[model samples]
Target chain A: MKARVHIMLKTGVLDPQGEAVRHALGSLGFDGVNAVRQGKVIELDLADGTDEATVNEMCERLLANTVIESYKVEIL
Target chain B: MKARVHIMLKTGVLDPQGEAVRHALGSLGFDGVNAVRQGKVIELDLADGTDEATVNEMCERLLANTVIESYKVEIL
Candidate 1:
């Protein structure tokens, strides 16, 4: 089984990296890019029969920085 | 409207950041975490009624490093 997890800063949190990227985009001639919020993607391949609870545990334990980022997981 | 884009390196690509993260996890007492692949998450808040085609164009033109990362978008 494979799972994809997305981790992102919560709303109202500061994102300096994202701001830097936005500035770069403007320098590269992309207009109207109002904002950028950078985040992380994690791909996991697990043994068969892994439950959603286990996946959540993985996020809580290792996959996310919960103080700043929240995560969503999709199993396939 | 909002769209979430996930960008990741294709399988077999080197991911040094993920490797570092995995090592950190081990040092922090996580067990059985064999591998980690790092990628990016982008959140776009667009005006209502934005189409997927436009989103795709934004990604193709700037949001991804097409040489290495592939992206998937989900609208909400």
Candidate 2:
């Protein structure tokens, strides 16, 4: 089984990399761009029998830094 | 209103950063870690009237590369 996790900053957090991308996009002719914030995704191929609780635990334990970000998991 | 976008590589795509992170985790004493794939999350603080279709279009056009990645949007 496979799972996809998305980790992102909470609102009001600063995102330097996304800002850089936004600037880069403007230089590359992407107009009307207002704002950008960057986050992370993690995909996992888990052993069979792995359950959602374990996955959520993983997110809280190591996969995500709860201080600045939150995470969502999608099973695929 | 705010929307969060997650961008990630499709299955079968290579993820150098995730591999690097896995290695780093191993060195940091995170055992039993088998695999990792990295992706991106974007947060959008949109105007009052922006719709989901437009947000998705943004994902396809500039927020994500369809050639290598897919995206999801969340409203908060």
Candidate 3:
């Protein structure tokens, strides 16, 4: 089984990397890019039948910094 | 309109970050975590009706390192 965790900055959190990417896009002549938020995706290949609860626990424990980020887990 | 781009390394490429994370997880006592691949997700808030072609071009030009990575674009 596979589990994918997407971790993203929380709303109102400052994202300098995302801002830099947005500026780079403007300089590259791509217009109308209103906002950009950069996040991380962790793809985990686990033993079969690894339950969702464990994956969620992984997210809560290590995959995300809950102080300023949120995460979602998807089983595939 | 919004667009989400998921960029991931091509198979066979060495991902030191992913490996480090895996090792860290093992040390943290999370067993059965066979493999992990780390990637980036870029969420774009765009002008209404911003077409997919434009978003794809952004991926080719700036969002992804085409040499060692592949990207998927999702419009929302």
Candidate 4:
């Protein structure tokens, strides 16, 4: 089974990296890029039947910093 | 328009960050994790009609290191 965790900073948190990318794009002549947000995706190959709850637990315990970030788990 | 670029290290490339996460998960008692791969997701709020080709250009020129990383762009 494969599971993916998408971790993103919570709205209202400052994202300097995203801002940097937006700035760089402007320098490269791409304009009107209103907003940019960067996040992390972790792909996991887990034992079959691992379940979504287990993946959620992993995110809460290790994959995300709940204080300033949020995560979504997808199982496939 | 919204665009999402998912950038991942090419297969056969070493991903130390993913390995570190796997090790940490094991130390925390999560087992049977066959593999872990870490990647980046960049979300952009672009002008309407920005088009997919523009996003691909962004990936090739700036957003991704094409030599070692592959990226998928999704327009939504």
Candidate 5:
């Protein structure tokens, strides 16, 4: 089984890296980029029969900082 | 308009960060994790009429390093 995780900073949290990318884009002549938020994606190759609950646990315990981030998991 | 970009390291490239997370998972006693690959996602809030082409150009020019990574763009 394969699991895909999308981890993103919560709304209202500051994202300096995203801001830097937005700035860089403007400097490169790409206009009208109003905002940018950077996040991460983790692709996991799991053993078969690994259920969604286990994936979620992995996220809560180590993959995401729940205080400032939120994550979505998909099984494929 | 909003655009989402997913940037991932090319297959066959070494990813120390992913490896580290896999190790940590094992240490914490979560088994059956065969492999892990880490990537990034960037969400861009753009002005109306910002098309997919523009987003792809951004990726090509700044958002991703073509030599080592590939990116996907989705307009929403």
Candidate 6:
């Protein structure tokens, strides 16, 4: 089984790295780039029968920083 | 308008960060974690009417390291 996790900063949080990317894009002549927010994706190969609850617990415990980030999990 | 870019290391590329995460998970007692891969997502707020071609150009030039990474662009 494969599980994919997407972790993103919550709205209203300041993302300095994202801001830097935005600035870099502007300097590179990529106009119309108003804002940028950066996040992470984790792909996991899991043993069979690992349920969604277990995966959710993984996110809660390790894959994501829930205080300032939101995460979504997709199992395939 | 919004564009989401997912940048991932090309297959066969060495990913030390991903290996570190996998090792961390093992030490944390998360069994059945066989393999792990990590990537980045960049969300961009763009001016209205920014077309897909322009966004692809952004990825090709600035948003992704084409030498070792492959990127996908999603416009919304």
Give lDDT for model 5.
0.97
Give the alpha carbon lDDT tens digit for every residue of B1-76 in model 2.
6778878888888888889877866676645558888888777766667788777877776788999887888877
Name model 6 segments beyond 4 Å from true: none
List the candidate 4 regions with Cα displacement exceeding 4 Å.
none
Model 1, residue pairs in steric clash: none
What DockQ does each listed candidate score? 0.48, 0.40, 0.93, 0.94, 0.95, 0.87
Task: Write down the TM-score for model 1.
Answer: 0.77
Best by lDDT: 5
Better of 2 and 6 by lDDT: 6
- Cα RMSDs, all models: 2.8, 3.9, 0.7, 0.5, 0.6, 1.0
Off by over 4 Å in 5: none
- What is the clash count for each candidate, in the order shown? 0, 0, 0, 0, 0, 0
Q: Is the docking of candidate 6 incorrect, acceptable, medium or high quality?
A: high
Superior by lDDT: candidate 4 or candidate 5: 5
The segments of candidate 3 whose C-alpha lies over 4 angstroms from its true place after superposition are none
User: Which scores higher on lDDT, 3 or 6?
Assistant: 3
CAPRI docking class of candidate 5: high
TM-score of 3: 0.98
Query: For candidate 5, lDDT tens digit of each residue in B40-66?
Result: 999999999999999999999999999
lDDT at residue A27 of model 6 (Cα atoms): 95
What is candidate 1's CA lDDT for residue B43? 75
Model 6 lDDT, residue A19, Cα: 99
The DockQ for candidate 6, computed on C-alphas, is 0.87
